[model samples]
Target chain A: MIVIHADMQIKPEKREAFLQTVQPLVAGSQAEEGCLRYTLTQDVANLNRFTMIEVWADQDAVDRHNASSHFTGFFKVSTDFFALPLKAEKFTAADV
Target chain B: MIVIHADMQIKPEKREAFLQTVQPLVAGSQAEEGCLRYTLTQDVANLNRFTMIEVWADQDAVDRHNASSHFTGFFKVSTDFFALPLKAEKFTAADV
Candidate 1:
């Protein structure tokens, strides 16, 4: 599985708007065929920090998700909500 | 549900040993009750970086896991393998 940890730091004032903006993206992504898991989470210690934990079947699935309207639409309005540029890390299960 | 993203940056030279050490912890944790998900993943871009994405049923489950022998055992030897101090973030699902 392809796991993505997308970290976002929202402006304090934009918190409510950010939540509203991301709702559809979360719902829409979860409905996608290859989306194994897609969830938005708020950091327990930092209310302004949020992370989107995404699990996809593979790179192809991620490619499609990136191209979806929900994904694109979020980006269009997301610029104003950010305190910093988004940071994302991609990982794959470790087989020790 | 409670989610934890524990990030570890291992020493490049100790990568092999670190992987071996974490293997048992992963197995042991997975066998524990209330462990909804417990996985260790290696960063795709940074080979020395790894993250443990853990999902627990509740705070009680996390407390138990924290006190587990397997968890403590790994930590005993983990200091030598790490390139930096461990960083962890606790999160809960966003309801908006």
Candidate 2:
């Protein structure tokens, strides 16, 4: 399995609006093939900070998800509300 | 390695308070042995929803962390702020 943690920082005033824009994208991601889990989250201490935790069957599935129209749409609107560039890390289980 | 994804819900108005109470715990957890990564996040669409993504070297590390005073303090205050039961899942890499 492949897991990804993406950290995002949103404009404070536009936090709600940013969330609204990304909701559909999140839902779409969850519906995709090989998407074991997909969730959007915000930082408890910093309301403007957000993160996405995703689990996929493999890198191929992640590649396909990224290529989909939904992701494109999500990214297109993201720049407007983002406060900082999104940061992400990928991981594989150490033991199976 | 062991990966855990925990889902939590907080009362909207008390979200900040909950985060403040947990921040120290999170920091302490990261300082523990075998802790790889730990982060707290909120749902993009739901401000009251939160999640934690954690990576540990093994289950033993998790157990030790849980037994520490930090987790106990975190849990104590968590009851007053949590909107629902915390939900968590464990996963192992498929291609390790």
Candidate 3:
């Protein structure tokens, strides 16, 4: 499986709104064929910092999800609340 | 549950050694009562960067794990391989 961790720093005041806005996309992505898990989490130390952890069957699965309309729409509107640019890390689970 | 994501930048030359060094602690941590999952993964694009994703049942579970001997032992020796200081993020899954 492939793991994607996207870190976003949202304006503190907009945290609630941002979460509400992305809830639909989270659900949509989780329902995709290759999606194993998609969860949105807030850092305990910084309520404004959020991380979305996504597990996909493969890179192809991720590509399709990214191309989906919900994702496209989320990306378009999601930038409005960011206090910092999104920082993402993708991983291929180590067998060892 | 509590989720802890630790991002570590290992010296390129020490990558393999670092992994080997921590393998025992990884196994030891996974065996703890509160540990739901403890995985060490490398970034697909950045070979020298490693992220340890740990899931614990709760704060107390996490505290106990941190206070364990394996954790203290690993911290003492593992700093030898670090290329950068550790960056850790703790998260609480949002119910919404």
Highest DockQ among the candidates is held by which one? 2
Task: Compose the digit string of candidate 2's lDDT tens values, residues B3-32.
Answer: 888888888878889878888888999899
Q: Scoring model 2 with DockQ, what do you get?
A: 0.47
Candidate 1 lDDT, A1-96, residue by residue in tens: 566778889999999999898888998999998898686766533668777778777778999999999999999999999999998866553211
Q: For model 1, how big is the iRMS in angstroms?
A: 15.2
Q: Which one wins on lDDT?
A: 2
| Candidate 1 reference-contact recovery | 0.00
User: What does TM-score give for chain A of every model?
Assistant: 0.95, 0.93, 0.93
Candidate 3 docking classification: incorrect
Q: Write the per-residue lDDT of candidate 2 for residues A1-96, one digit (tens) a residue.
A: 788878888998888788788888898999999998888877766878877888888778999999999899889878978888988877774323
Minimum summed lDDT over a 10-residue window in model 2 chain B is located at B87-96
Q: Is candidate 2 or candidate 3 better by DockQ?
A: 2
DockQ for each model: 0.04, 0.47, 0.04
lDDT of each: 0.80, 0.82, 0.77
Model 2 residue B14 distance off true place after TM-score fit, in angstroms: 7.1
The TM-score that candidate 1 achieves is: 0.53
